[model samples]
Target: MAHWFHRNPIKATNAVTFDFGGQASTPLARNICSEARSARSNLLTIFADPTRDLTVLTDAAEKYLSILRGFVEPTVDPNSQRPPAQAPNSEGGEVESMEVSSSATGDSKLRNAIKFTWSNTLAEKHSSQHDFVFEQINILFNIALWHTKHAAALAGAKEDIAEDDAKEVHKCLRSAAGIFNYIDDKLTVKLFERTGDGTDLDPNIIKAYAQQCTAEAQEVTVARAIELKHASNLVSSLAFETGKQFKIADNSLKAVEENLVQKWRKYLQLKATFYLSYAHCYNGQTLLAQDKCGEAVRALKESKTQFEKADDLGRSYTSTKGAGKSAKPHEHAFFRRLLPLVRRNLEKVERENGFIYYQKVPEVVPELPSKATYGLASPVEFVMPSKHEDWTAETYNGFKISKPDAEKREKEKDDAPKPVKEVPVNQTDKESSNSSGCTIS
Candidate 1:
């Protein structure tokens, strides 16, 4: 009966096209361009008149499409053959829907219906295949996260933004957060597949992918806490889960070399400790926001231990292997900035816990100049012409060399003579001034 109900293939191939505010051949290109237009219009409108005039759902949909594109279509250099050599790079897209046909006898009408249903038309294309592609998922997660960060940055930039407007932006963030978590959950399945009953696995590649996924999972949790303001208990629980995942990845590497394994474990432990510290700090902040002072203090105290361990590990690692080598400029700068802030947070928690403060609060340091703003504030260095170069006066017919019109107006104003008028005063005031030996000239 099931076989009798099967449908026959209606067509050998089907093409898909999208009309995204206009016609486009490819769905990806059409969707991207359409969203680009909407986003551009929204931003331009906002710039012209800073008001809550945006369609929030449309904005969220645009961001969602961005994440989808990042998953399905990666940026290409056009010249490079490889897809920018991202980790676990692969090609993936919506699978073409094809009806399964066999030599078995079945009703022709039913078969035709089945084939029509299975056809790779815009309305009937299979969607499950897209979810199986891991690279696309990761890219989508990252892009969604970038959108969340973008929204936060936008909120920070506009001082006069209304509460309702801010709430709209948060709605976008919430959607992004939800998608990110979904992908994270899906990635966990891939992690287990790689682990494969804890046996018969390559030491580096498979385990490395798992570790990468778990580490990114930790970051995703942190992002959730930051953007969603997840509950303190949930955030703390996630932090512990992240630590456990790191331990699992580390433990899997035991069959490898001792020194190598030890170093890997150390690095993993270092990361886990730092993430835990960040998580605890987040939990403390969450509690503090809810007016749970005691709980906040406790969470912050726990964070201090993890932070100290991370600091110690970082120092030890640098002193040993990085003895002669200087740290990267960004790393050096980040550590320099972060250390004091960590100290301050810890101090504040301690003070809240009724500890006496012997030392005065540290002076606030002004932010160092950013490299991006260097060109804005500093003049471009003028380079002298090379000795071998010939100097010539370049002239263009379209160019104007006369003084500007503003200068001419200023000259006319200066040349114009001024007219003066005499001031009138009350007779009594004038007489009093004269008696007091004072007079208006």
Candidate 2:
């Protein structure tokens, strides 16, 4: 009887309910109760088990239906009038009838009644939160399929596993892929859009996702490695693009170029030496990597030297260019006159240092006298004395001689004889002097 009740609890419970209606039967009610409890216990055990075999689900579903059946009972009361038990229709008869009903009205009423009862029963037996619970169940179902595939693989029946199990695993993998794809799309869009706007998105997130994608690829077959590689390349490209954008936004190109030239120049020289040494050490001339390294080092060093020279020359040129528009004309003229002098001095220094000096000599102009006595002086001359003299006493004393010598000079001037006039020329003058001389005695 227990086996029978477990096999068909609904029929058993209905039989007991009908027997109680016709004749009072406490034994039948007790038997029905016992069967329902046993079935519920077995169902709970089956669900609690970790193994999710299809057989277990079928058993649990059967048990759940049995538990529902055991809850149905016939009410009994001798003093009160009660309605007759409605016969179970193929589609259960309506618990209530609607007045003034057309054929559509009658159908609608029956449908609403059935829907309400069925939904209420399902809710009461299950839960209001069943949607969330069912979703979790579905996820578990996928996980179960995944485990089954893994088990088959481990059991050496890899080929024999149902195609559905593989499909299930693929489905899960696809979900993970979708997540990655979404992130990739989002990052790409943001990267392109914000690139011009000059924003730096986090790089760590991209790196992490890339690692995840790579890790996920391990589960895939070798045939999919190429796909994985493509994905990885995309990630790498995005990272590179992001870094480049950041570098440009930061204006680090010039600084980086300068730094690289500075750093690599030394290594470049060593690189050539290193390659030659490597070749000799290994006794092989075909190893070109070392040579390339050396060449790179030398190239970088040369580049650095050139850059430094250019920078210095630029600074010097700018400094000597002078400043301001107003100062330019004067600066030009000054340089025009002084450039020859500067070049001459520079050449002299270079010559002293045993270097060849190649400066042009300036034309020499001879000094001219102030007086017109020299051909160099201008013909138009004023009576003004030479500007060489000043009125200072020192100038006057420069010409001073002895006073006696000065008088002697004067007497000599007096002692010099005057020239005598002819008598005929003074005859009238002599007669006039004799006529005027008589009154003077």
Candidate 3:
């Protein structure tokens, strides 16, 4: 039964719910790996045959979404009002099933007679909180990608997908966006928590995941524009958010590129460029839809330039020793595939609306200054030591200091003063004092 459920979750969930009558006593638990596998399989099936029935593919995606949501952000079950179950050792308690094997008895002694069943908590501890969410994001992205492609193909065939299951497609895209939004909101909370308390975890992981969510959300928004044949309100607003997300992602990728050296830096930079080009490409489409031909041209041009840069860097990264062997052929295939569309659209827009007000301007990014100049340890001042009237000081190869001797002065006062003739006294003898002592200051 577990194998069947793992293989087919949608039907299994339905069966379990029906058998238990929506109660929690049956303990219908979900396996994250199994769910992820099922989702990936569904996506691969769609990719295998793009012309497959959209209805079946969409149903599979929705089911996978439900399963994934349970993993990362499970909602309170409405039927969870029943009392909790006691432990297996208590009255009316249920023992969790476990497998036990027995070996042949040898010389009146039994081997492997006892077996212990490990609880679910042991497994749960091994999986980090972010792991499940990351997996879900990957699945959701593929689902959204499938929806976008299918919906756009339908739009192309029928001028608009509004009449033919448009609502379903819209729902899928919106769910994808919702998943992304949920991730972003929770990630913000996690970051705040880590900020207040010292945490050893690297925040770059969350930042990278946030970038994926934003990029996938942007893809959904762009697909919606394409399907609806308009981009005035919804698309325009989404473009603003998407652009901000792209900027954040760019900063994160810059940090990553800085940490790497030589070929790796170029490789990461190329990946960053590929991600940015998608944003630019979609933003260009949005601008063109709004009839801002000049801005649209600029965005599209930027997209094309980024594509060229990515290609060159990618080639450079691959030409290095050992990098080519591990290179992924589909690494930036999406960007490459989209570049021609951007170029074609740019030409179409220019031909329809002449490039009268378009002009390029050069911009420079100055290096950021060091923090030491105005930082906490800045504004230093020098101080000089002051000499006291009672002390004598000298510096040569070493410093010698002399201070008045109170005891010697008192003794001189106590003793009878000897009158000295004012005959010739050497300058050094006049400067010497028996009433003073010297110390390093």
Candidate 4:
């Protein structure tokens, strides 16, 4: 035996001591409890994650199938069994013949007999397995319905159900049909097992199920058609509005218009492609829906291209050296008149491109000379000098000497006699007297 210590005031001044077995059990229980709590928390965390939720859904589907299988068939107990009740005879004696005649003559009597026989057979065949199958069908149908509704809510089409939702509805109907098919097959199997022939048993149940499937499929088709029509109308309206807003005035605005047209065209082309693809999927031929979509796209693209070209022309016109600048004073007036057209076109582009159309236009300065350099006079005159003659200082000041005064001064200087030089008076007299005497002798 193991001894356990007890705390006593007399022994060690301790207040008390617990039994070893109980104390050991307490620690073990706490450890187990702590582990269990941690496991539960971890499980809860995993369940909260979305990925885990999808996995759970899948698992649930599989489990539902298992439950369905269980309902479809069950093991029969060998003991405590009783014989089935005897059914009324169809041909029982003259009293019997009379009785049979009475039974067969009335519709209500005949119907009741058939119903009772059929009910008895069904009860005999009923199994947990069949119930399980029904449960599985129900579960799948509900799950599909839930997914459909969830998707519809997400799409903001509370009133308008999507194709996928419609498909789910079909699936549910098909599941119901499947239940009937299963029962029919089971009935056939039982008939064959009992009489080695199943051709004689009525196929009303399977036929009815198939007919229901057909009806559901038709409904889905109708729903899809309606949805497609609505979508087409919406897209058409948008495309029309886009086309209406583009304008073609002024070079800058024209460029914007062209770009917008191109964008709109591309958008139309994309939309048409989508519609054509949808048409192909739906196998729709009514109204030549696919062809119309293609045509619309092409037409829009061509229109956009033409608009772009027009814009290019406008840009070229405005971009010319003297575009905004006028040689005449009235040119500004012309531009002012055209300003409205430019504004309208710009607005059109803005509508088409959304935020992209609002981009800044490049700054363009007019080429006209500044007013300070070129006077405001019309028919500007340029007075050029007669020739490349050098201008004298006086000529530059606008003061000129008269030609007659210049000529008079020149003649006076030329005609005036030179003064005679007087030699020394004595030398000059002697030379002159000697020359005179020589000439006289």
Which candidate's TM-score is highest?
3
RMSD of each: 28.9, 58.8, 34.7, 55.9
Residue-wise C-alpha lDDT for candidate 3, range 1-441, written one tens digit per residue: 000000000000000111111111222321332443565455545533333567777667666555544333322224553322222423554532211110021110011111111111001111112123344433443444344344333322322235435444344334434433444454334321232111112244334433533343354445455456553334434434444454564465444323222433343455556545655666666666666666667776776786787677666655543211223212322334657776886686666456453533213211111221110111111111121111111111011112223465344212221221111111111122521111000
Worst 10 residues of 3 by lDDT: 1-10
What is the per-residue lDDT of model 1 for residues 326-417, given as tens digits with 9 covering 90 to 100?
Answer: 21211332223434545676566557555532333223321111221111111112121121111111111111112123444334311211
Query: Which residue window of length 10 is worst by lDDT in model 1?
Result: 1-10
Question: What lDDT would each prediction earn against the true structure?
Answer: 0.36, 0.25, 0.36, 0.26
lDDT of 2 by residue, 1-441 (tens): 000000000000001121112121234444443554464445434433223454564455445343332221112233444432333323665322221131232121111110000001001121111111121222222222232222222222231334455343333333333333343343244221221111111223222222222222222321132224433222222222322232232232233223222212221222222222211211111111233223223323332333344334323332342111011111222112323432343343334334332322223211111211211101111121121112122221121111122344334221211111111100011212321111100
Give the candidate order by descending lDDT.
Answer: 3, 1, 4, 2
Report residue 288 deviation for candidate 3 (angstroms): 7.2
User: CA shift at 184, candidate 2, in angstroms?
Assistant: 35
How many clashes show up in model 1? Answer: 4
Q: Which segments of model 2 are wrong by more than 4 Å?
A: 1-25, 69-161, 164-441
TM-score, every prediction: 0.32, 0.18, 0.33, 0.21
